[model samples]
Target: MARDADATKVRILAAATDEFAAHGFAGGRVERIAARAQSNVRMIYAYYGGKSGLFDATVAEALRRMAENVPPRPQDLAGWAGDVFDHHQRYPEVLRLSMWAQLERPEAGAEPREIYEDKALAVATVAARPLSPIDVLVFIYAIAQAWQLSPGGLTGLEEDPAGGDGVAARRQSVVVAVERMVHAQP
Candidate 1:
């Protein structure tokens, strides 16, 4: 069978996403990505320039998926928080990849800034009380991600047939926190 360049690139990206998400930029290896992709290192370099480029592309793709999957709703920040929590639950890799990017490569292109600025502007426009748009946006995001970072448990997550409401309870807490923040904005 003949090789298809587009398919090869897709495979490379998917593999890179996994490798980079798990290992981060400094630790992520092009060879692992190539091996996972069932292709060669040369293809990765040719398609993405190098390891840095592949990491950038993988992060960009994760952010793109995140924005598309859980779009910000300035008017309904609480609902948006719930959606964000749900998105994180479904795609933890995306959040991990983002965290890795922020730690390893803090500098970002205008695309992320633009997205934040747009959301902040909308949040400011709809906010009941006078508030810092950036602060509000950041708070909402932090609240939504709280449960993902911690389940309010000392022994990890809890589970019981009697009153085990780990995921649901955590999700509800995230939504309620964002709601309270939105309501209490000043």
Candidate 2:
């Protein structure tokens, strides 16, 4: 019974991720998420309280998945940044969800604190020189996600009009930038 309940929750979260990514918090429809998850509205409320709760849960789950799958490797910041870029490309929904959270729900609860602490420690230990771990992490994340979030704004000005390999080029640019940032003196 517990297994079945967990499955139902997972289904609901997956549906909510797609719904929120497409429509955001204000525009997202709980009824649609229920339909997509094959679960009723009451069940959503029972599990997640309401639309806000569901959104929070969806974002939390997305972050958890990313951390588990693409944890930062401070010793290899460039490789880690490349992996992050790939993950963002593959799971663009996560980035969309984050954007919505920032724009629409700035007051939302912070990301898991322990994750931040662990990442900071890892980065501090392997840093080439003294640097704020938080700053390094933020820099790497921004470089990796900037293109995905705003390709036209970020890469359009300088990129060739007919560049067929934009993604590859941007990814390499991100890795190089991360390497430089990690190694540069504060």
Model 1 pairs whose backbones collide: none
- Residue 146 miss distance in model 1 (angstroms): 1.4
Q: Lowest summed-lDDT stretch of 10 residues in model 2?
A: 155-164
Report the C-alpha lDDT of model 1 over 93-147, residue by residue, as the tens digit: 8878888878888875512666676777787778366558788788877877875
Q: What pairs collide in candidate 2? A: none
Q: What lDDT would each prediction earn against the true structure?
A: 0.79, 0.86
TM-score of each: 0.86, 0.89
- Give the Cα error of residue 33 in candidate 2, in Å: 0.1
Model 1, runs deviating above 4 Å:
108-111, 151-164
Residue-level lDDT of model 2, residues 1-186, one tens digit each, is 244778889999999999999999999999999999988899999999999999988988898898899998978999999999989988999889988988888787625667778888888888356557888888889889988777666556865733657777878999999888767776
RMSD of 2: 2.5
